[model samples]
Target: MELAIGIILGCCALGAGICMGIGAIGPGIGEGNAVSKACEAIGRQPESKGAVTSTMIMGCAISETTGIYSLVIAILLIFVAPNILVNVLLKAIGLM
Candidate 1:
């Protein structure tokens, strides 16, 4: 029983770690690309810096949502999933 709970918790931690790791990669790359492009645009059209900056900010913010979602899911997996899973396991085994 204890072993089962330990395994459940360990798995949850591992899953959360993996989720965050994979989730961060996309946004990191996307944001880097967006910023790079934005810099290039501003360099090409210095007069339109205001517009380019605003658009870049919006794009970066939108792209960052994916990473934020992954963070939320990871947090849930780490802090919430283990307890819920443990409870379900206990109930299924008639211990809860």
Candidate 2:
């Protein structure tokens, strides 16, 4: 628990939190916006609704991938790394 390591850990935690929160926000907004736009397009061009729906789906899938990665990283950071670090430190001190 040196000062520098503590600071680094805090920063990592903050970054991971921010990443996950923003990731969820961005994708949710993007998907909503995409759906809205697709609906508008369909309303304007009823004959091309199928094409609009397909493109919207593809774009949403691509946009959502980044959010998924962020979630996975955040989960690993928050749930996995701290425990592993604690175990390593405890073993090094022969207290575990």
Candidate 3:
């Protein structure tokens, strides 16, 4: 029972780490693309730099929420999953 619990928790931690890693990838790519395009636009139209930059910033901010959500999930998986798993295990084995 103890070994099973340990394995389960370890897997959960690994899953959380993986989730964080994958979650970060999309935001990173998106932010990079947005900034790059914004800069290119600014270069093409210096008179509209301010507007372009502000819009790009807004877009980046919106894109970042997804990464933040993933991070929250990862945190929950890391910290909360183990406790929940333990409770479930306890009940399953009639210990609860």
**Candidate whose lDDT is highest:** 1
Tens digit per residue, CA lDDT, model 3, 1-96: 989899989998999989999999999999999999999999999999999999999999999998999999989988998999999999999999
Across residues 10-45, which tens digit of lDDT does each residue of candidate 2 receive?
766987899899889889999999999999999999
Per-residue lDDT over 11-38 for candidate 1, one digit per residue giving the tens place of the 0 to 100 score: 9999999999999999999999999999
Clashes of each: 0, 0, 0
Alpha-carbon shift of residue 68 in model 3 (angstroms): 1.9
Candidate 3: worst 10 consecutive residues by lDDT? 4-13
User: Any idea what lDDT model 1 has?
Assistant: 0.96
- Candidate 1: lDDT of 51? 95
lDDT of each: 0.96, 0.85, 0.94
Model 2 regions lying over 4 Å from their true place: 1-19, 92-96
26 Cα displacement, candidate 2 (Å): 1.1
Candidate 3 off by > 4 Å: none
- Candidates arranged by lDDT, highest first: 1, 3, 2
Model 2 lDDT at residue 57: 98
Sequence-dependent TM-score of model 1: 0.93
